[model samples]
Target: MTLVQRELVEFQDVLTPRAISQFLGTEAWALHSRRSFMETWVHDSGVGRSLEYVHIPTDRDAPDFSRRLQETASTLSRVYAISMGELAERVSAIRADLFFVRIARDSADGTIPLRQASGLIDSIEKMMKAAAIVTANPLAKGTGRTSERVRNFLDDDLRMGHTKRGSFIITIAARLHDDDIGHGADDPGAPEREGPAAANRVTRREGRADEPTIDFSRRVMTTLSRSLAVTRRHLDHSDDFVEFEEARESGMTAPIVEAIEEIATDSGGARVDMRFSWTSALPHEGLSEEPVIFTPTAIERAPRVIERFARSAGVPANTDVVGPVIGLSRDTRAAGEEEGDVIIQADVRGSVKKVGVTLSGNDYNWAIYAHRHRLPFTVSGILGKKSGRWWLLDDVEVDASFLIARQHDRIERLGGDAPEDPAAPVDV
Candidate 1:
């Protein structure tokens, strides 16, 4: 498609010499010549055609720099049969895998509710971290503190991009390391130099011997795709929790399951759709481009899968515990004590038990609302027994959606003339 003038202008605004070089180099375009203020890159488009050259300005102060850059982009777009914006986006993510995660709901304007937005972002981060940890060590549990290596991968390599206005889309760019790019002569797309000797020479530097040949970005994406695929299939076919146990070796872990559960619940049961775009710099093998979706039914069944796997691992696992408020501890007299603490009788591991969970901040307020309304309360955390009593250990999220749903139901039942919702104080 021909790129419009607006598209060319937008691409020119962000295009730079370095980004152009990276894109050209990755696409196997050879460096033909270098001038004082400009560099020429040539690509041998096969099938009996002359070599094509693109002139890139080395200095922004060069004459007609923006016009030259736009011309270069337009030429590339025509040659590749793509749009200027597409070319620019590919260049921008030349060294990264672009991941798009969208919440597919009834929001025609592409905006999500304020409360669900925070929950969605937190869940997406958790989900990706869990995938990365599992990629580093397939046997590793998805819970507890992340290792130093995994933390570095997330902090340094991963980046969050601008949000899109298409049903609440989140863009994540996972930067590819040196090990991720292919540079050997064996690669058909490897950049070739001018000389015969340089034609066979590797362009990019080799990674350290200690580094794994497979980069973390690709591996993590693969693990996430496979895990979500397996969970969706299992939830579709079986009611037995043993299926999760069987799928343990397939990267089905507690944290990923819990993360999906939280995301689905926080979206008010909307399906989560995730799309992965592999970087063009390297060869991607056996990874599907099809979107991975976590349906509402699968999410509803996720809690059991997490609980079953947690039992097999013999450790405190993350899962959602939902039930009515059985008791509350308002005693703030003790040291480090706060009012509005909650105790709920929820079904845990096949039997009903009283699960105690401490609350503060918005969570404390939500607990009070649920108790006053006699609505079911849901919280996710590490479920374990302490002093013969069950307690949610860490990272407790007091879901406020239940209160909202209950209030909505009450309004409907009262012929649309119910009192103001008590849950209105909480945004979620």
Candidate 2:
């Protein structure tokens, strides 16, 4: 079956709160009265501020609390199971959206963890692992739902804005699938079809099949690498010089230029070219916000730069600049020099810097900074440098001393020698 089909089946097995309570050997009445396990405990704000009291009611007719707890646990478990199933589907989907049957069979045979699936994605896997580590210790059965604990668990490990309980359950499911597939028994086929003799044969086959096949995680990594390579090539050859002479410019060119320069500096002084245009108009009333115009020229080239940087840094590609009719900009500045643009600034954690883009009339500018390097950058330009005098700046210079010092410090920290840059021809 296809991954989607498998997902549909798994989704149907989602358990209800009553079922969860029964599984946990708890009364349904107590579970429902406390808002589904989240309101059972409170955090003290004073010194030694930890969870003070855990309210796991015993023999009480806390129908509301019982129902709540059952609901919460059931919701959490069901969500997690569905998420794991989806992640498995995603991995198979990466092979072919309809390859879930093979993928599931392979997974059951110990080929790969469900977390390695494309549906789970890297971000989801990371979140699942983190959640697994935090929630491994099962809370006391009657401790009610500890929302704060759950929230903290999600916050410390998961990406922001993805902390819903359902989301958390999905993450947990992926982790469970990973663990189960890693150490669980292989499917023994239909019992009636196999019988005792067939079972013996299956066991013998499993022992012989102990050797691992193509590592699913590695395959995923390889697939991502190849996809990124193709994306990089497209970005490199994209038509980045097109212009929109007829549209009303929202004045974002300057900010876009600044973003390019910033990207170059962050990229260790690489070379880059930037182009920006409005994709739509800003709303004058409650009708809708003006949609800044995005030219085709900018859209094609943006993803190449983004994918290149993401691959080099071992990060996920940003999706904002990957689509058409979006105000797009491309950057290929020299490594370290890319940091001079607002769009490519690095944080203390070495994450990409983000900045807000503002449009005014036929021009625009960006306000962004690199937290780690403490470097600030900006972009500004007009709609048409020739007719409307709109020209985009694709490159910028960085403080050479700062770059050298930073490079040296990084090398020293890593106990390694500074690497030399290879000489290459400039295309522009």
Candidate 3:
């Protein structure tokens, strides 16, 4: 068997002459000259400053096309005080929200353990999914089916860029829609315009729309930032998760905390820094321009927080939940005793979530029967979460009456009587 590795994307391959010209045009560069196969763009700083010129190849098929493109990129990098890779990314994702994650470790080299490297990528993806879910549905607990909008955004709009040197750096880009672009200031770093004129304009704009429009991309990042900030503060100051619970509206969920823990643990307790770079093309407001650093203490406390959040988001105690028996697991037990775990596809709140319940003796037998019959099972218990799963404790029993009624409903929905022969066992 042979393994083929994915080819890395290089700046020289992506940063073509046309991309350079478009980027330069946005930076106020003016066309200086044109030749048979090339064009010159000049950026003049007025007065005493020397004019900076970049040569762009008009013909990509020309022999010196690649060379001219590299030269143009180098000159632009120098002019912008950024690396060629950074310039290339800026040009490529002009309308995207950029996130940079750097994993710090004791190792001198930039390489990470193979296990941790895989974990890092998986964790980053989970973090983005959490953010996107919460942003679109503010009250989402992330225990249910994800919306199609979020799934589409993750599949189509989000992108992972090439990794860079210096401990391990991951770059993520989330492309913004055109309507999402016009909300923020053109200059991200510039101070908000002041005085009565700006104030009156803001007032007039506020009057135009009863509710301010939400930028999905910006909202996702903002929610993530707020939730992370809350987590860090909670770790720094208190042990109680009351404040953390309040942050649910800010996109703090079990998955987000778990993702942070994965990154922190993979880095071997070293700090992890996450930086945000909002596109200048659509400069967003209210996002923390400052980087969020996951300190050792915060990382250490993350597991506890994740547990608390999951438990908090779980179904309330002493409640009766009815759902189909989806799975059953039995292990060796003492003589004359029947003990096993049964998984119920219960509806929690408005979402269907799997609830794990342990039953013994008659209850266990009944669960097996329910599983065999493909019938909905009803159980009354306290629902809690552990190890990222929902568990039911105490009073775990099948409601015979509710089960019968649900089975009847299923048969009715089928528009006929169930066959006399037992239905084939459902694959859990």
Candidate 4:
């Protein structure tokens, strides 16, 4: 096979643009709350600035701080059973709003006008309280860990001497999948986000004409994409930290957390970790980095092709099967299926059967996805009962990235009512 192209691509996510948006939307309030936590304590002065007095000898906030930290930890245990490392890696990075920090800092120096400072303290406190409540919500447990981390980020850094004086921004870059063969404009392989920078409102440091408009989508894509298919071991929270027992009882998989330690490791490129410092600039130098490129050698052809078999013959009322498939034969007749309807064949264990499907109109995408990927398809209903293929489905789901793409495409055919799936950022 002749290799065509190969390169590293980095983005916050690999899911379809729409799913990524939804996932990011879920994390948005969490990010805002986490940032608010940092601002409350650190005041954005960077190194050596977090609740500076809290770590001192006469610190009155210590007890409450510790209690709150513990409270946050308990909330986390209730909802998220992920590991500390996973917690750190999966949390989104939200940059501090320097404006609020600056105003507060200036007030201390008597430079801020009384008008600006009057309700400012009240407003800040309100925001902090709101943030605390948001973080404590078990329904969005990821924020609990993020809240703790952001609240203590500066202090931890100061203790470790990793604190830098300037404001920190989150940066993103894609490391292309090592095995990614190639990408085309229309395919999912391309992670290039087609839009302005994720955050369009960039403030250029007076002399820095080279400032880059950061892409919020890029940051989001990277954050959520990295979280996919990854699962941490279940932790047993002691009685002191137990609150959401019902959450634990229901299990953590409903929110789509899975054990992807192996599959995630093999499938995607390295995840650009955003845990410690959320610098807005990635490693490629300048504001943003280019998408890593890759070469495609030769596409492997599947051994079999399952064509869609027409259900012309009498069919049993109950029959279903799932397994690898081949393309349909050309001779089959079509009922309600569209023009590209291919025959499908699945052999569960040892039973092999063939069948065709009349779909629920073209309202769903993946109209030709099976044909494109040739993956296993489940055949159920009354069509293939005579072939002795019954109840063979294992109910394993396809990846969300693929599932959404198929869904998004179908909804598009229904005219103007379909919501467009956002363009997804691929790698980094």
Candidate 5:
């Protein structure tokens, strides 16, 4: 069977909530707590700063942090398992004209940057390793050997050192999740929902199996995105340090830390909250008139078209393509639809020429997927003329440089990139 066929088969077993819990070796509720903790820590710890110094002053804080960390570790264990589940769900939704395509060739070649994909794989691997280390020698768990390993990977390997600082922020934040619950039980707030009458309602509601459920995946994704944002700020601080060191050599008066403080204060405190929103192209009966067709043929050919396009773009033929399958749509007034503008399009030739590529609603969907999966895609490429036409040209060049530049700018702005020194004075 072809790679597409293989993916189709694999998608049958995609991730589910119960499966995710099993893979992570933790319950959904516990994972939620862990995600909350990480997000909080990222917010509290100024970017680029070490998290080791953050103190959990109270016994309550200590237990919360420990519990959250433990839960996170457990959840990491189930990464692959959960991924399988996700894949399975996607496959199940595949239509006759569309199926999952594997770019194993591009992934293998260094053409596509595998950093993000590798990071994700490595995250799961490291988690497993950590689990092994913890289980094999339980004594090291408290020493944070596993946590340290995971943190170091986030810092050194992923070039996300700021995230390590944010981890502490998460630790602190986890305490807040239940603070209201604990406080309300003892002390009531104005117009409180914790009086005797409220208590009876709460007790009554607890018995309902269908209490509004939290979307754990969304929660986790949001927490991680926010953590990345804070980490990006910390990275900026590190860059500032580099600048400070260079300035100091030139007899500059201010210290780097001071500069950081000044900037932080001026900016109304250095805090980041990365927001992500998703929209589905799949037609909603009430809001949209577009039809979402799920054809197996489309699913089977997408990967081939993507791979061909990647190859035509001069990217390596070997690269692992992995991530959530996303569909996208937009809201525009009926009049706006009449406006014609130039849009870059993708052309794929050969047997896969008719293949269609489906993308999530917003550009960020692809960006996040590429970032998380480490797929180096041409940000600026010719837009497909029709909704899903494919072609190949001898010297097809797409000016995706703009997209790349934008991505780079965002990364640098968020402090994900090392700071560049101001161009030295040029000799006259």
Candidate 6:
């Protein structure tokens, strides 16, 4: 496809979300009248933050400097640049902490736990700063620039009022069919705008019960949580960029975001309705390029990876597949003391293989997690031709040892005793 032709083909096509929807087999990843709450403060980091890098002779750094620095050391809008999204993904892949969350919102029925949603605003802030440092330092070298201060909002700073005030309607759309980009047809969600009817817009299948339904707000929050966790893991465990290439397969090249809906805030915070659509198709690399790195700690503990499969009932070695993890089986200790297992929706190339693996009864710490309710993972190993299933055998890296970073330096995990909103749903 020619450059102009490709752009034209991609035009108005809400591709990625649709691709995501399609990948998810949903009608649309859409939410309606969902509320979003954010407290914005006039911190140097939060206020007037720019992806555009400029030279002060004294400084040059961007967590997500999206600019190519081709001519006159110019810059580009993060909304337009893929690098910022990539930077965000890289940080998220590590699943590090960017916020000290405070539980705030939930559904009246208590089904939607906004409190469970990972704090994203804080992640964005942290990543932006991190990107600044990474782009400049290259090797995790500390920037001696005193002009920068840790992104902090507490005590006396909170004493000063910083409340964002406003109300607006939003429509987030996605269309996937490989026309050009996950770039779905242009709708109001394209660029942040204002108005009333604008307050309410509609996609083809607006609120069709049969179309598809997903708790998008919760999904967003979950994504934020997972991203934070990955960052925390990477920062605490691995050394440098080695993690990126360690895995053989990657969806990192997939087009995740065509654009970003930059949140609006001047006062410490703002609340708005967040609507989502779970269409039929979306992209492979999530909506954000920030990847979720899966380092299998379970493999190290497994007694026999390939040999176990060899002994299984008519198992075939080296079957490649990519799909979501369905469920994790635990001991009858949890169920009825049944043997442990891991269920997977194994898409072997194009074939749909619903497979399950007997677990080692251990590996829980590094074994299971749900990405959007279904864990999307990839592995190449044995598949029983008869039973059509296999166990998670060993770590991907056969020889390399892994290390975990010191725990003291981590952003504290939200403890059970931590303060939660009194207004939040009751513990059921």
Q: What is the lDDT of residue 207 in candidate 6?
A: 64
The total of clashing pairs for model 1 equals 1
Which lDDT value does model 2 have at 423? Answer: 18
Q: Kindly report which residue stretches of model 4 are placed more than 4 angstroms away from their true locations once superposed.
A: 1-214, 218-256, 259-279, 282-377, 381-428
lDDT of each: 0.68, 0.27, 0.66, 0.28, 0.27, 0.27
Range of the 10 consecutive residues with the lowest summed lDDT in candidate 6? 252-261
What lDDT does model 5 reach?
0.27
lDDT of 3 by residue, 1-428 (tens): 11111111255444755445545544667666656577777887678989988787766568877666667776777788987666778775555667888987766777788867876877787778777887777777654567898888889888887676777888888876644332112222322332222211211235567544555776776777777777666665556444665666555677777677767765777898888877654445666768887788867777678657646656355767788888788857646677788888766543345678887766676677687877677787876554445678676655666445555576679786664532321111
Candidate 6, residues 1-428, lDDT tens digits: the string is: 54333432332121222221112112211222211121111112234663322221111233222121211111211323443223222212111112222212333442222321222333233323333333333343112231232222111111111111122221111111122112211122332322222212222346683443322222333343333333324322555322322311211100010001112111122222221222212222333324333222321211232233234324354565456666666666666323466556654322233555554322232235322234354545555422212344433211101101111112135333422532111121
lDDT by residue for model 5 (1-428), tens:
65434433443232222222222221112211222123211111346853311111112244564444334322332432444334333222210011111112222333323433332333223322332333334443211343553444334322111111221110001001111111121122312221122211211135575552322222222233322233233334443223323422322211111222222222233231222222121111232212222123323333333334344446542222222222223334434222111122212221101112322223434334343444443333332323223222222232234345555665668777432521111110
Assess candidate 4 and give its lDDT. Answer: 0.28
Q: What is the TM-score of candidate 4?
A: 0.19
lDDT of 4 by residue, 336-362 (tens): 543333345553222233444433223
- Span of ten consecutive residues with least summed lDDT in model 5: 167-176
Maximum-lDDT candidate: 1
lDDT of predicted model 2: 0.27
**What's the lDDT of the predicted structure labeled candidate 1?**
0.68
Worst 10 residues of 2 by lDDT: 275-284
Q: In angstroms, how far off is 106's CA in candidate 5?
A: 12
- Top candidate on TM-score is 1
| Selected candidate, larger lDDT, 3 vs 4 | 3
TM-score of 2: 0.19
